[model samples]
Target: MTNSAPDVPATPEQLRRSIADRTWTSPTAGILDGYQQANLVVVPASAATEFAEYCRANPSVCPLLASSAPGDPQLTYDGCIVDVRTMVPRYRVWQNGRLAEEPFDLTPRWREDSVAFALGCSHTLDGPLRRAGIPVAVTAPPVYITSLTTRGTTRFDGAVAVSMRPVEDDLVDTAIAVTAMLPTGHGAPVHIGDPAEIGLADLASPDFGVFPGIGPNQTPVFWNCGVTPQLALAEAGLEYAATHYPGHMLVLDTVVAA
Candidate 1:
């Protein structure tokens, strides 16, 4: 909800701690510059395997980072420890495929049968893109459910979700090349130019996140969004589930190679 930048800690651990303490609750788009940010998907142990398979079938949008053992709240990757219960700034709790609540922490909702999966987030590339002289939005970009359907699993099937960024015509290739180096950030764009080609009719109104407004001479570039799993989760009608609210990622100590 809030787009204004809050004073953030210098390290990822500190950032996580701050988030846990409720000191920071804004979206993680442009903050914490180089550290990797992860999209979260916590499901029951019964659906974990199928969900993991779903991620594998759609790597572009769900580049699996790390998963936690059932009933465990922690996920470790490259020496970084992330507590799924409290580290993320916000969480979306789903019940039977319907979004039940948007909570600041998952502590109360964490269950004995819960399994958490971390997916690569496009926010990880924001710092690199900005450093490359490309103007990046401070808040999360608009996300739309496209006509493109992801390769699905028995329990998970849905249309692909993409986040759109407006890039100057000249910087389009530079933006692509810069992001391509980091697969962990949903590397490169999935679509460019016309939004209708991707089933996006109106850029002004998005299915998720606020539209950042495309300017003249700037082309709309779309990337496979980490939010894709939420669509699957909705379609699956799972009894219980949790995910990072769009753009509110778990900051990881590991930096993506750019």
Candidate 2:
């Protein structure tokens, strides 16, 4: 879990070049180590208010790490160090309830009034969980279909998506306790039993990303996934919208504590 490369201490440029060269196509959890990685949600100006409302209604699911002003793809930062337009590894351009394209960068799809949002994800807790010797059955963050309904509105409505972590039964309590120390990362498990109870019929069939293998002694612990907003956005058929591929999150320069 401690994937700290002093050579690449989680910078925006490193991410930009990595994506440009197509050297990084998979999840981003183990790449940045302790640095927090955030999920992305890109939407048009017209739906910004409705999307904001959805985020406000379900803070834990979205967390709302940062929201850009309308017409801006770059997040508000000093000297413009963090560019949401090209930093994430991969992006999903969704329209009409389906993915239109999966691009490595936004140069081809950038537009005015497209607000980019960064939300908390379970990847923030991966370092701690792996440090505890818990064999994370989840190789990459896996989004699960949930029975929980996100507080919806006139513009968007959808079921919640949760990330699963399979922990040993005896270690579940400790795992929860450790992540609780980092509340900004959608801390703790929301559900600890069968996925069927959460409306998910199978663990192998995730709506997005690769599925993690569940071992005999492991139990799937569910946490609110940041993808919840992207799902709602996709469900609304925004005509034009982009989201970071499920596990590819932005690595922030600052540190987050519980």
Candidate 3:
């Protein structure tokens, strides 16, 4: 489905209110420019510690942002209160590690033992990339499950997921440098040039998100994506879990420096 631009509010809190009210449910890219965006993961209290450890083990793919105590619907970062069940535009419900449904509000499925986690999203780097004169794709970029595996904890172990963006051949270095400074945004490109080296045979067909074709002078650069946790959740095969839909992230009030 194509995403249409909505009337964006001036602040992250306002945008979040719109999202909670179902006024804005599209992929949040290029909106709320300087604010940090985050990927969401809600799991049962039983698996929360293991999942948290798994994220810490692989910082590039899952940069830990903030986590909520079990049964707590809210996550706070930068003194901003984020209601995990309502703040996100859309959520993917997982049953037995499989995607069961995509829901706008997670309230119906919220469990008393549920624990929510927020991870750094690469979307936070969009402003810096644009300021560096790099072209960022208007649509969500393609994400692939790589052959490379992540350092896993007891319950979470699986291949890493990487998001691809076509960068001008000349600005590849700048892209890396610009993103590296923002550790909260998944940092820098993990792979560059060949997708096959990472087991992506067809660049045209990605495992997730849309594939914006590469330009003649552009090179495909891959970054460790927040979606990595989703793959791990599937691998763990938990009875129930939840995550933000790919590209639809939780907009945070935390202001990031470009």
Task: State every prediction's TM-score relative to the real structure.
Answer: 0.96, 0.86, 0.96
Tell me the lDDT of candidate 1: 0.90
RMSD per candidate (Å) reads 1.7, 4.0, 1.6
Stretches of candidate 3 above 4 Å error? 1-5
- Tens-digit lDDT string for candidate 3 (1-258): 334547788999988998888888898878876889999999999999998899889988898989999999999987999899999999999999778999999999999999999999999988889889998966677889899999976789889888888999999999999999998999988999999999999999999877899999999999988888888899897999999998899999888886
Tens-place lDDT digits, model 2, residues 1-258:
122323443565576566555665556766655667788888888887888888887877787777898877678532344677778878889877788898877767878879888777778888777777776643576777788887775677788888887788899998888887765688778788788988999889988767777879888888988877777877796778999976777776655443
- Candidate 3 is scored at a TM of 0.96
Give every collision pair in model 3. none
Task: Give the RMSD in angstroms, all C-alphas superposed, for model 2.
Answer: 4.0
In candidate 2, the residue pairs with backbone N, CA or C atoms under 3 Å apart (3 or more residues apart, or in different chains) clash, namely 71-113
Relative to the unseen true structure, what is the C-alpha lDDT of residue 34 in candidate 2, on a scale of 0 to 100? 64
Weakest lDDT window of 10 consecutive positions for candidate 2: 1-10
The residue pairs in collision within model 1 are none
